[model samples]
Target chain A: MTNKAARNLFIFGSLFFFVIFLGLTVDTMNQIDGRAPEITKDVDAGKMVWQKYDCIGCHTILGNGSYFAPDMTKIVEQKPAGYLKQFLMDPRGVNPKAAMPKLGISSQEADQLLAFLTWISKVDTNGWPPKPILAAAASVAGQPQSRGQQVYQSQGCSACHSIKGIGGTSGPDLTKVGANGKDAEWHVKHLKDPHSVNPKSAMPAYGGVPEADLKELAAYLVTLK
Target chain B: MTVKYQSQKIAQYFYTFAIVLFLVQVLVGIIAAVQFINPDIFILNFNTIRTLHINALVVWLLAGLMGATYYVVPEESETEVWSLPLAKLQFWATVAAIGAVVLGYIWMGLDPQANKTVMGTQLLNEGREYIEAPRWADALIVVSVLLFLFNMFMTMLKTKKWTGIQGVLLGGLVFLALMYLPGMFYTKNMIKDQFWWWWVIHLWVEGSWEVIAGALLAFMLMKTIGAKREVLEKWMYIEVGFVLFTGILGTGHHYYFIGTPSYWKWVGGIFSSLEPVPLLLMVWDAFRTTREARNVTNKAGLFYTVAHAIFNFVGAGLWGIIHTLPQVNQWTHGTQITTAHGHLAFYGAYVLLVISMIYVTMPAIRGVTTYNQSRAYLAFWWMTISMVFIVLTITGAGMVQVYMERLMGLDYEAVKTVYNMWFWIIRAIFGVGFLIGTAIFVYDFFKIGKEPAPALAPAEQKA
Candidate 1:
């Protein structure tokens, strides 16, 4: 093509796509109210807190930012606030091997940050960050989960521990923990107060857990080998 | 040196200063690469290190681009810079701003509280990925860009000797400056904020920057390779036309999972799939013109130019499309795959483009038809090959991550197996390689071409 013709094409194409992009951007902005959660005062503060700590530099949210740490998009769902608070206050207290360093987060800041994450969890990302294929397959297989396994997921145990490769690094891998000579009684006591068994252990006490579920969890732990 | 005016020498300061920033970028980058394998090493905050690395990269490349523009505009417009004092003011301001920003980032790292609000504003480390410069630094950056733009426009207008290259360059710069505006504001809606962030980041690299690269590359090809101006400009228009058509819309790919509509899935997929077309056409045009040229005096410059085109295709065009489609991106979006693509793509597209322009501009400004060819060629291979090795290792790590973390439901931490560790190890080794290569490049850029030993005629065309 002659330079003039190509120039015309360049001008025409750039304007056309740019206009369309602007329109789409407007439409996207319009959809934000419906797609994203309301930004309460606390939520806004939490976002600032996130920025204040430069969290995005270490974590991904909605598949954006540096991927140094875990995805924060579903953190509120994967981890309960109680555990999150403990972790935020002193990262090592929740998990000894945690990569996150304590930044002296205030009790109030923790709540606000959680609120922000709660808002993030509610955003309609159009089903982004697809479910793990193996997890999906496990559910599809329709094998009934053990009561202890249900308790584990419900309690967000995976936030701290991994059974295989599928959990946090803060806690010990329990993939073969059943091989330990400790009985269910020992396991139960350790769960209730890990410090009683190992004084330096960073694991939080599960004493608040129901006695029945604790027994089931203990029973399940012994079978992991 | 055959520099036309006193103003042109300002670019030399920018070029030299930018290489120092390049060193900073690489040094931090090596630290970051190691941190990838062992996140527990809090000796340096990975976030802050990365912030410095990427921000330095942005600053240096812009410094390089501005310098190149200042040099090229004078030659293309057939007039001197509009105001030498203004250009000098702009350069010093930019240098001061860069120094302050770098110090500000280090300060933020030492005290995370520095990023906290002071009278209701984060003073240092805005903490966004690329534009993490503090609020004050941001203002300085805007003023600097405006000054550059004003000087450029005045110079272009002084003689009114317009070429297609200058027009495209102006359009691209305006687009770049406008895209940056949205990043300065904070959107209450996180989703909307993310949407605009993509516009700034994606458009700068893929959209406007590519247009500017086209102008720079076309000018170099015409001057150094002796290509016909008419034919090169025609090809430049076509190549840029494809770039805009695909790139502007290709911003959709980033929209897929960031709280944007599902229509983006299709739009991003289709448009981005065609993004490779522009790079493809650029390489074809580059090779064709190089082949048809009557004389090629600046072999080192020509080599960098051609290398930029080819690597852009491989690193950006090929690697980008690998995971751009929604189906593939769903698994790879936040994985090391993105990291791999980012490193390679930046190096190939803009980093190499800037380096190529430097290779071309240095000899021309020095009035040397050719510089020390052997050293230049050695640096090129050292950098280009080592960069490929780094990208490949990271791509390997990314694939393993996708398998274990996404497909296999492994924990993010669990992916740090010995197998994965191997990738990081290899990557760190090559990170050092890339760093050494950069050192060679900096040396070659300044030291090798210290004096013009002799003049050489334009070599005869092979054909």
Candidate 2:
């Protein structure tokens, strides 16, 4: 082919490709717009709790937020409503050293927040965190321990410690803590006061968990291994 | 040979070294991708795969930079290289140092302690640490950089006139030298160590690189495309302006989630997001110049330059902005989204630009007017397509990973098992494309030197 003809071919090819790319981009945008779930009353209530707490200031949800706290959009799916409610009433009750301040939420507000969370849990997040074990546990019904994992994150338990191989490395890995053979009684006492077990421990103590929730959380922690 | 041609000769050597390194880098990238697909492919070691990725990227970029500096320096100086022998010696020494470092990595494995040698210093292998070369190797690299600087700066001093392109090019090399300052002090603390390391790492890739790319783009178009000097120089100035505006602050993006101060989120996101603006302007300026050129001399080289512009826009300018926003980055920071960006931006903006320079200059060195345009064009498309596929696969995988883990609360192990097959399949597809591109590139490089020259176009005929 003559040089002029070759050059023309190249130009035409580039233009054609550009047109195809534009069409694909528009189609993808349409699909994304269509798939976006509507903001219903349930989601709006959850959003209020999120806004009131300034959750986005510290935590990211679906790739949006500050990194100070764990993402909460998926929290309801991972953790139980009862456990989330209790933790909301008092974060220090879940993780004594949690950086999250107690918001002093009312029972009704907490229920609204739970409903909002449940709504968020149902949104298709497209398989993040990429762990089947966590995904499976997150979907399990009445699993308070699964909820404990969310509590572990939202309460900033992961700021210093890693759980199930995901989190910050500043503190110790929690994967082996439960499997280390500590008795339930010992965990209860330790939860009340961590310094009793190890004098040099930097871990803070929660006042105490209610007996029932404590057993479930302890059971979840033990299964981390 | 004229003094101008002497400088061209030096550039030729640098180009040959860069092309070889490019091929090696592609191979290493393929291996790393394969390992990601099947963790057991390389004995189930993340450390090994990560090492390959990091080291290959570093070497390939350094090689490209060296070649680009050699090509641009003499033209800007209006003189030949100060000492060809010294330049050659520096090239061989760098090759040796890189080889030793790679050997250490494969032999002794990746020791954080072994990787401790700061730039411009001597690396000491205190014991069995393979990754750390003998301290002399580090000192050698510094000496080599000094020789390089002396050669180029002395040439410029003799010329006594500084063009905008020259200024940006020299500014980048000087910053590269300055990057070593923080690495002088090594700490046992990983957090502190990484903080210092980023000064060298981030500064080179995001900071000096922008300057180098802008300068080289201007210089090559002026030389090859018969572009108006004034128009190209103006674009160079605007390009450098945007680079400096965003480059310094962009370092903060790496600082996020690295246990640094929380304020980096705002600083890194806002500034890094702006990094694409200059690059986008660059794309516009490149194509505009090409379209305006009254005479197109080398069709193949022009094709490469145009492709470089398009890929830079899509890969560096667009994709970079997507993840640089603070909100988006909070989730995508360490995921495969970052990997996708790295593959494209590094190869597209930097590597391809250097290769474009080689296409323009290698013929000048051989005193030829035409090359195997078909082969060169084919290789370009091969690389472009493979890179696009790789980016899509990684981005798709990252989305899936984030949803499964963050949204679904799936543990790492379960997620790993579920996504294992898809990761491997996608990576293998990318590898096939990458390998094909590399083979074509190598074949074209060898064939060009052997082919008979075609009739000279008006531009080259004038020269």
Over B264-309, each residue of candidate 1 has an lDDT whose tens digit, in order, gives 9999999999999989998998899888766566778888999999
The best candidate by TM-score is: 1
- lDDT score, residue B154, model 2? 82
B371, model 1: CA deviation in Å? 2.2
**Decoy 2 TM-score against native:** 0.67
By DockQ, who's the top model here? 1
lDDT of 2 by residue, A102-198 (tens): 6557677688778766655554433332343554564466355465565564455654466665654434578788778887677767767777996
Q: Which 10 successive residues of model 1 chain B have the least lDDT summed? A: B454-463
lDDT of 2 by residue, B313-375 (tens): 678778888878766665575456766787788778876887787777777666666665777
> Could you give the TM-score of chain B for each candidate, in order?
0.96, 0.90
